[model samples]
Target: MKRESSLKRATTETDVSLALNIDGSGIARISTGVGFFDHMLTLFTKHGKFDLNIEASGDKADNHHAIEDIGILLGKAFYEALGDKAGINRYAFQFTPMDEALCRTCVDISGRGYLVFDVPLTREFIGDFETELLEEFFVAFTANSKMTLHIASLYGTNNHHIVEGIFKSLGRTLKTACAIEAGNTEIPSTKGIIE
Candidate 1:
């Protein structure tokens, strides 16, 4: 059986489609109106070693809604694909650095939506994409996936590097957290369930 889920979402402002594999080699095919954001997501999937396919088109008037909605859809796909969340590692963390920027990301599929963002920067826009939209995306992803996510950019000068490091780190951490543990047929938590 394919341990994967395929999903699509549509609104007046955006049309999004996604295919996700919980376990696979890093490979991605992605497109969005915003080039840089698409690059980031591709890098995230590539470095995290996930097989992902995404396509989205949004209103030219605003990229925020499209970007954030994609996150929500992707997160929902993850939860649906994972089913009962049994026999999974359940937690993961990674610290990644890009040029002068360093970021740490940690995640837990705890059935509670929470995002702790610590990126402190003055600028709200990264090229054509809004930096604030990154937070919005993560928030939507967390809520839909019912996962607790923590992302921190401890130090960075360039916005590009900071954001890139965070996404890549998040990808790696998530890949680690979702791996199946050998000889373990139950959830990874002591509470007998992740949810």
Candidate 2:
């Protein structure tokens, strides 16, 4: 069975919907009023080889609600799609470089959601998307997806490059972590369950 999920959320601040496929050919169709965020999502989907589609609308221009909500919905989709996490590798890491920037991302689908973000951004905003919200996005994602994620930027001078590298590295790491192991049809934990 193909691992897939579709989810939606509506609030006074935003309304967002998402669809995800863990085993796919890197196809993405995303729109949220935030252009920079859309670009980042596209890169993540492409690198992860995950099929994702998102549509969001609301008070996205003046605040952080839209981006955060998208992260929440996406994370929920992932959790729903992965269901039981049997046979998954469950742990992976990757390092990606963009121009003069480099970032490392590590993930464990341990059913314990936590995030360790240690990145430095050279600017406050990258095309209207606040740089600090990058952490917020990942925080929401990690908590909802029930995974432990650690992202660190070893070095970076350009804010865009650093952020791009982070997303790309995260995508690659998740791709591996979610992969199925050959002849290992069991949950990755010693307890015989992931959650």
> Which candidate tops lDDT?
2
Off by over 4 Å in 2: none
Which candidate ranks first by TM-score, i.e. highest?
2
Weakest 10 consecutive residues of candidate 1 by summed lDDT: 186-195
The backbone clash count of each candidate, in order, is 0, 0
lDDT of 1 by residue, 1-195 (tens): 356889999999999999998777888999887988988998889887888899999988888889988999889988887777778878889999999999999999888889999998778788888888989899999999999999999999999999999989988898888777777788766787765
Per-residue alpha-carbon lDDT of candidate 2 for residues 142-191, written as tens digits (9 for 90 to 100): 99999999999999898899999998998899999999988878988889
Off by over 4 Å in 1: none
Name the lDDT of candidate 2.
Answer: 0.91
Error of 2 at 90 (Å): 0.5
Q: What is the C-alpha lDDT of each candidate?
A: 0.87, 0.91
